[model samples]
Target: MSINDHRLVQCNEKDEETLLIFKKGINDSYNGKISTWSTKKDCCAWEGVSCDNITGRVTELDLKQHFLEGEMNMSILKLEFLSYLDLSFNEFDVIRIPSIQDNITHTSNLLYLDLSFNSYVSSLSLAWLSAHSSLKYLNLSGIDLHKETNLLQAVNTLPSLLELHLSECNLNNFITNPFMEYLNLSSLLTLDLSKNNFSSQLPNQFFNQTKDLTYLDLSWNNIHGSIPHSWKNMKYLDYINLWSNKLSGEALVHLSGWKQLRIMNLGENEFSGTIPINMSQILKVVILRANQFEGNIPTQIFNLSYLFHLDLADNKLSGSIPKSVYNLTQMIKFTMNDRTMAVVELFTKGQEYEVQQIETNRQTIDLSANYLSGEVPSELFHLVQLQTLNLSRNNLIGTIPKIIGGMKNLESLDLSNNKLCGEIPQSMSLLNFLEYLNISYNNFNGKIPTGTQLQSFNASSYIGNPKLCGAPLENCNIKEQNPKTPTTSMKNEDGDSIRESLYLGMGVGFAAGFWGICGSLFLIRKWRHAYFRFVDGVGDKLNVTLMVKLNRFH
Candidate 1:
C-alpha cells in the first residue's frame, strides 16, 4: 500500500493525524469551496477544538454557529477519536442530500452528537445511525422530519442516549414495535415532543416507563382524556406542559409529587369542576383558561407563593375577591373573564378580609363579564404594578374608585355595562399609560371629565344616563333656566295626584248619585199631583155654580 497507509496499518502515525482527520471533515462541509483555516496550523487552533489534556488526542469537535454550510465531509468522517460532536445552527443547507453509508463506518468513537436546527436534515432514520455505538446525546429538533420511517428507526440505534429532542418533528401516528424496540432511554432526563400531531391517548404506562424524565412537554397536541393518576410517579418531573389540548375532568390533585415543577400550562381545554386546592402551592406559571370549570374560588389557590402568571378566564367560577389572593405576591398576570357564575362580582359578598402581603409584582387582573354583583373591591388598588384591569359586564354598582389612578402602569381599563353611578373619575385622566378605556352603560350623572385624554374619548364612552347632561350633545351643553326648578316639580306632582283622586271618588260615589236623582223625581211627582188637584177643585167650584143655575132653570 501507500507509505501513509503502511504507517496507519502499522499503528505508527503521530497523534496529530487524528486532528487532521477532523480538519479534513470540516473541509468536506464546504465541498472544497472554502478552507477550514487560512493556513494549515489554524485547524488545531480552532475555537472548539479540544485535545485530551492527557493524550493530546482531538476528542471534541464543537463548531456551533460558525456559519458553516453543506453536508458533513466524507473524507473527515474517518476520524476515530471524536467523543463530543456538536455542529448545531451553522447554516447547513445543500442542494443534494448526503449519504452516510461510508462515513459512519469509519468514525466510531463519537458519543455526544448534536445536529439540531439545520434545514438540510429532512429525512432521518435510526438504521442510518445504528453504527454509532457510543452516542449518548442526540438532539435533532427543528429538523422537520416529515415521514415516520426516517426518525423511528434512527432513534432506536443509540442505546446510551441520555437526552433526545424530537419537538416539532410532525410525528403523530402511533409509533409501533421496531420504532421503540431498541429505544430504552432510561438515562434520558429531558424529552420535548411538543407541537406535534401525536393525537393518540398516551399509554397509561408512559410515565411508569420514564422514571428519570425531568422536563417533558407534550403540549399543543390533540391528546385528550383525564390526567393519569400515575402521573405523580414521575417524581423527577419539573417542567410539564400539556396545554392547548382537548383534556377534560377535574384538576389534577396532589401536585406535591411534582413539587419541583416550575412551569405548567394546561389551558385551552375542556376541564370542568373546581380548581384543585393543593395544586396552587406547587405552580409558578399556571394557565388554565377556556375550560368548563365552575365553583367557588379556592382560598388556598391564591397561596401559590411563587405564582407569576395565573390565567383561569372563561370558566364558571364564583365568589368575591378573597383577600387571600394577595398572597400571590409575585403574580404578574391573572385573568378571570366572561363567566358570570359568581355570586358577588366584587367584594361585597362578605369576602373574609385576610389581606396577605400584596405582591407589588401583579401586572394584570381581569374579572370581567361575570355574575359578580356588589361594589368593585377597593383592595384591587393593592396591585401597584397592575397594567390591565377589566371588570366589565357585571351587575357591579357604585362609583368608579378614584384610587385607580394609583396604578400608574395601567394601560387598559374596561368598566362597561355596570350599574355604577356618579361622575367619571377625573383621577382616571392621570393614567399616562392608559390607551384603551371603555366605561359605557352606567348611571353616572355629572360633568364629563375634561383633559387631553378625556377629550379624546368619544361620546360613546359616556352613554346611558339621561341625567348626565353637560356632554358634547349640543342641547345639553347650553345652561337651562330651570336649574332644579321647584315650580315645575310641584305642579307635575299635584296634577298627577288630583287626577288619581278624582277617578277614585267617581267610582266610589256611583250609588249616592243614583239615589239622589231617584228621590228628587219622587218629590216632584207628589207636588204635581197636589197642584192638579187644586186646579180641578177650582174648576169644579165654577162648574157647580153654573150647574146650580142650570138645575134651577131646569
Candidate 2:
C-alpha cells in the first residue's frame, strides 16, 4: 500500500466518537493542543491519541502536563481496547475515581494507568482498582488516599503490578508489623510511597516480599525507627530515598550487600552512629546530612569514582576531610548540610528556575560547621569545575591558596568564621563568574582585592576582619590623626626656626637703616637740618589737610 493510502485510512468511528466526547469534557482554557480531534482530520493523527495499526482503534491517550481542567467523562470507558492511558500532571479538579460498579461496566484492557500529579483527587479504594487485572504500571501520586484504610490490601490484589507510585498520597493509616504476613509482589521493581504520612516502623514483611525491587522511595514520610535487617536480602535494590523522616539507628550498616545500590538519601533524619563503612562501589549520590553521625568520614567512600554528590553535613562528624576527596573528579557537590553554610544554586529566577530548567554541571564543596581543623587542603583547588566552595564555621587555619583563581567556574565562595590569616589572595580577582563571597570573621589582614566583582560586594563580606582594608572595607594606607608624632613635631620645629630667622633679619635691617641715617646726619649737619625741615613741612601739610576736610564736613 502507498504511504498516502495508509495515511488516509480512518480510525474506527466508535473510537473517534469516544475521543470527541472526551475532548468536549475538558475546559476550553486547557492549554494542550487537543483541538485537532475534529471529524475533518483522521483521528489517528489527533494530538494525544494513538490508534492500533491493525484494528484502527484508539489504544493510547497520553495527555500528561496539559494544564487540563474540568471532569473526566465516562466516554473514555468506550475505548475498552485501550492499553495505555496517561492523564498525569493535568488540572483535574478533585474528580474522584469512578466506583467499582461503574468501572466494571466496560472491562478495560488497561496495562498502564497514570493519574499522577492531580492533587485535587481525593480517596482511592481497592474496589476501584481491583477491576483492572491486566494493570502493570499504576501511578496515582498526589491523590488523597487518607481514607483508603485498606490501601495495602488493595495493592496486594494487583498481582501483575510492576511499578506503583503512590507518592504524596496521604497513606496515613497504612502500617504493618515486621512479622505481618503480606502477599508477595515479587514482580515489582519500583515502589514510591514518599511524602506520605506513613507513621510507623518499616514492616520487614513488606520489603521481604518485594525482593526484586530496584527503586524504593519512602522519603518525607513519617516512617520511624530503624530499617529492619531483612531488607538486606533485596540485593537488586539500586535507588532508595529515606530522607526527612524519623528513621534512626545504624540501619545503613545492613544495606552493604545491595551491590546494585547507587543513590541513597538519609538526610534530615535521626540516623546516629558512623556512616556505614561497607558501602557499595557503584554508589553515585549519598546524602546523610542533618544527622548525628559521628567519627571520621569513611576513606573508602572517596574511592567511588562515579560518586557525584556526597552530603554528610549537619552531623557531629569530626576529623579532617579525607585526602581521597581529590580523587572525586566527577564529584559535582559535596556538603555537610550545616546551618547558615551551604552549597548554593545560582539560578536567575530564584529557586523556581532550578526546578524548571535543566541542571548545569556545578561542582561544590561544603565542609562548614564542623570541628575539622587543619590547613585548607591544596587539593581542593584542583577541582577546576568547582562553582561553590564553603568551608565556613570551622577551626581551619592558614591562608587561602592563591591557586583558588584556577577554579574559574566559581560562583560562590565562603570561608567565614575561621582562623584563616594572611592577605586575601589577589588572584581571586581572576574569578569573573564569582557572584557570592563571604570571608567574614577571619584573621585575614591587608588590603582587599580591587576587581569590579570584588568591589561590588558589600562590607559584610569582610566584616570581623578588623585588619582588612580597601573598598568594601576601610582603606589600609590612611594617615593617622596624631599631630604630636615625630613627623608633625619636625614640621613644627622648622616653622619656629623660620620665624626666628625672619625676626633677626628684620632687626638687623632696621638697625642698619637707622645707623646709616644717623651717621649720615652726624657727618652732614645741613642734611640733619634739611631732614627736620622736610618733617616739619609734612606735619604742616597733614594739619592743613585735616582742617580743610573737617571744615568741609561741617
Report lDDT (CA) for all predictions: 0.62, 0.75
Clashes of each: 11, 2
For model 1, how does the per-residue alpha-carbon lDDT over 1-554 read when each residue is reduced to its tens digit? 11121121222134345445434534344433335333444333445665554444556767777667655543343456777878787666532223545444564787888877766667554454666767777777667676655565566566677777776677776333334534556677777777777776666555565777776767677888887777867777766667677887774563657667766666667877766666625555565656777766666766675664455555676666455336655543444321211111121111212121222243445565455667776666656556666777767787877887777777767788878898767887788877777777888776766567665666776667665654452235444423556887799899999999999999769867886766565679876677779889999999999999999998
lDDT for each residue of candidate 2 in 1-554, tens digit (9 for 90 to 100): 11222554568898888788778768746555876568887888777777777777778888888788887664475587889989998877745444545454677698998988865666545466666777899998998878766666677778899999888887765555222377668889888888787888888777778888788878778878898888879889877778779998986776678888877777778988877668888876676767888888777876776665566666787777676555674643444332211122222211211121112255445566767777887877877767667777878889988998888878888888989999888899999998888899999888887888889889988899988888977766644222278888899899999999999999999999999999998899899999999999999999999999999999
**TM-score of model 1 (CA atoms):** 0.64
Can you tell me which runs of candidate 2 are displaced by over 4 Å? Answer: 1-6, 30-32, 74-77, 94-108, 177-180, 332-360, 479-554
List runs of model 1 lying over 4 Å from the truth: 1-37, 44-114, 119-121, 128-137, 150-162, 174-183, 254-256, 331-374, 390-399, 412-422, 435-554
My TM-score estimates for the predictions, one after another, are 0.64, 0.77
Residue 174 lDDT (model 1): 36
Candidate 2: how large is its RMSD? 9.9
